[model samples]
Target: MVSLSRVPQFTYQKLVHKIGSVDVLWFQHNSLDPELLMPKALFEVEHTTDIQNSLLKFQELRWFFVKMFIVADNKRRTEFAEKMKYSAFSELRNNKRVEFVSYDQLVGQYNMVSAQPSVSLLL
Candidate 1:
């Protein structure tokens, strides 16, 4: 099986809070209609950034993605956790599919997988 991750480059000029854009967006193509597609997941990288904006962007597109992730740095991770305590953000806190990934974890995972000598060539 061939799986690919599609990252959206175009700006979402239609969203209410058009401040931030999704860094990684994944989609699945229809077997019947080649042109028809649906979003599978989304990822936002927050390195020394605001969590509220990222959360808002994800909230707008939440219905489409089954899984969503917030990848943030150490400082941003703590900030995000604190910001997540709002009553209005209950949706995000209760969602089982949503995930938070720290920068250290992301780096460790990348390093672990790419540790092989041959992997460097592929990269």
Candidate 2:
């Protein structure tokens, strides 16, 4: 099972675009400025579906997220890497803005992050 945190609010297919729609858009909670309201993190999950489409969707919204995470199961992660264009994969490989994570990794991170109490609560 996948375990992602629900700590912050996110937009799901709320903001439309040409290719289709973003899977999940996570934003920072602050009143800094309207311009700063852009998503801090973008996520595309490909479990049993085509990772290509999910990747394409993230590519379309590359401007929105400061950091993007593409999630796939163990098998698909390798397959997606193999099927991707060399340049595209290189770009994905090079960009810190994008990351590819396996389901187990995600769950582990989620478990680690979510298990801790909020700083606000600690204060």
Q: What is the per-residue lDDT of model 2 for residues 58-84, given as tens digits with 9 covering 90 to 100? A: 666655546767787877767766645
- Which 10 consecutive positions of candidate 2 have the poorest summed lDDT? 1-10
- lDDT against the true structure, per candidate, is 0.63, 0.59
**RMSD to the native, candidate 2?**
6.6
RMSD in Å for all candidates: 6.3, 6.6
* Candidate 1 lDDT over residue span 80-107, tens digit each: 7776776656787777445778878778
Superposition TM-score, candidate 2 onto the true structure: 0.64
Spell out the clash pairs found in candidate 2.
none
Candidate 2 error regions (>4 Å) = 1-20, 34-36, 86-93, 118-123
